[model samples]
Target: MDELNLENEHELLNSLETILTSECNLHEYIDDIPQIFATDNLKTMSHKEETNGENIETLFDKFPMSSNVSKDNTNEIVTLKSKCEELHTQIERLTKEKEEAFEEIERLKDQILSQSTYCTSLGAVLGNLTWRASRFPQIVDTWLSNFQSKIGEFLSIVNGTFGAFVDTYRSAFPPTSNVEYQFVMGLLGIVTNISASPEGREFLITNSSGMEFVQKLIKLMPELPLAPGTVSLKRLMLMILYNVSMNKTGLQYLLESRVEDTLSHCLDDEASSEEMQLLCLRVLQSVTYDLDKPKYIHNLIATIPIEKIEIITSAKRSDISNAAKQVIKYLQHSQKITK
Candidate 1:
């Protein structure tokens, strides 16, 4: 009996050892095996064995290589977190910069609007100012010099204002509502005084800078319809053309620009005043006298309203009659030559 009890006890110790090794490998076997070790002594022995093995495994987890790996992982996490914070700060700064840039752009736009508005208001007194300026040759000379020096700036404003006027005139836009008309009239008044003199005409059409202004002006001329409402503007434009036409160089420039087409349209518009008709006729007559090219004469004849001009030859106004007669004679001669 004593030998059998010792054998059973030794067998139980071997089973407990096997179970503890399995529990260490699986981690779940410890709880499951405790039920099999129901006796108090066996349970106590199993607990003691599990506690010892757990302590050994905990020491292995704290080995130098594992400790170094944990430290490296903690450092990497901290570095990534700092980079994320830096990126967030930079994003906020860039967003603020973009907003500031947009604000500056809007401010610049407002300033430009204010200047244009001021120019429109200034137009009301431009006629008087130009008249006063014309009396002083020194002022006129200085003005002309300044104008030539800043021709580009001058034209930008003039052309923009004129283009707006053209739109207002062409559409059903309220004529009085826009500053374009008043602004144009004021500038035209100054231009009229400038073009009236031979020196001024040369400065306007012969100078390289002046040619650009003239070309732009010519391009805008055809867009103005010859109606009663627009007649005053048209007349101002015609006067400028006529004054500039006195210069041979200016005339050539005008002819090459096909200004005769615009003149023809004016002559045929019927809404044209007698004075306007006379101006158109005179310009056309000048074209006939200066036309050295067959193509020019042909173009002149093609564009002019011949029958209407012939009727004007017998009109009551002697100036208009004489101008029309000369233009008709040139057209008739050109027609015969073309045939």
Candidate 2:
């Protein structure tokens, strides 16, 4: 019995060694084994071997590589996070700068708009002041002589501002609002009478600035309608033309504009009163006397309508009759020349 027992112990030890060796080659044996150790068999083992040699080999192979890969992945993730943070900061700064630039542009636009409005208002005020100042001739003369610089400054402001006002207001109001129209006429009278003065002649010779003012006023003349019996506007216009005719240079200026053409239109209606006819006749006679200049004569004769001339000659106002007869004499002379 003792001998048999020793043999059995030797066989059992050898079996145990074989099982340990098989477990150690777990990596190689994984495909061959259908099942690892059964739960009941593991519990019956004297020493607890929770993991096989195959499992140990798997742990050794995977642990170092997986740890190194995890470290690399962690570094990549940190770099991406830093880049995202930088981009977010740059976007925020750009957004703020864009907002500030937009606000500044809007502020500048508003300031420009405000300044434009103020300049227009100032221009209107200066125009009205000039109209007021022109009402007194003596004051104008004194201002022109003693304070020539002041006169120039005032005229500069007036010319600039009134030119704009006439352009704007004439479109809004009727052509014959007596108060406003009279003020314009009065200003023209001031310009004409002043140009006739010795100081004005000197100013014109030196500066040529007043000529610009007169040209602007003459351009504005179409806005004033010939309201019947309201002689103030027509009188002022004729006076300006008369002054223009007196000087050879001024005569050339007046004739070049063909103002005579406008005078014909003013006298078209036979219904025009004697006073209106007289004004028209006077303008024609004054313009035609300078017929010695071919340019002036041609424009003057072309401007006088034959029918209106006949009607004006028949209707006699003592003031207009003399002027109309002088116009007839000039026309007869012009016709002879044309023939």
Q: lDDT per residue, candidate 1, 151-244, as tens digits?
A: 4455455556666677766644335335656567766766667777777787777656567656766776667654445766767778778778
Q: With candidate 1 superimposed using the best TM-score fit, by how many Å does residue 96's alpha carbon deviate from the native? A: 17
List lDDT for all candidates, in order: 0.66, 0.57
For residue 337, model 1's alpha carbon misses the true position, in angstroms, by: 9.7
Candidate 2 local lDDT, 1-339, one digit each (tens): 233367766764564454345444533434322232323232222122223433444443433332323355446434543543454354446556656877999999999989866765554455446656655677667878698876576557546755765675654543544344444544555565566655664464344566676566557655653444235555665565665555656666767777776577557654455666676677677666636666566666666755557656665466676777788788778666765
What C-alpha RMSD separates each model from the true structure? 18.9, 23.7
Per lDDT, the best of the predicted structures is 1
**Going through the candidates in order, what is the number of backbone clashes in each?**
0, 1
Minimal lDDT window, size 10, model 2: 41-50
Highest TM-score scorer:
1
For each candidate, what TM-score against the reference? Answer: 0.58, 0.51
On the 0 to 100 scale, the lDDT of residue 149 in model 2 is: 79
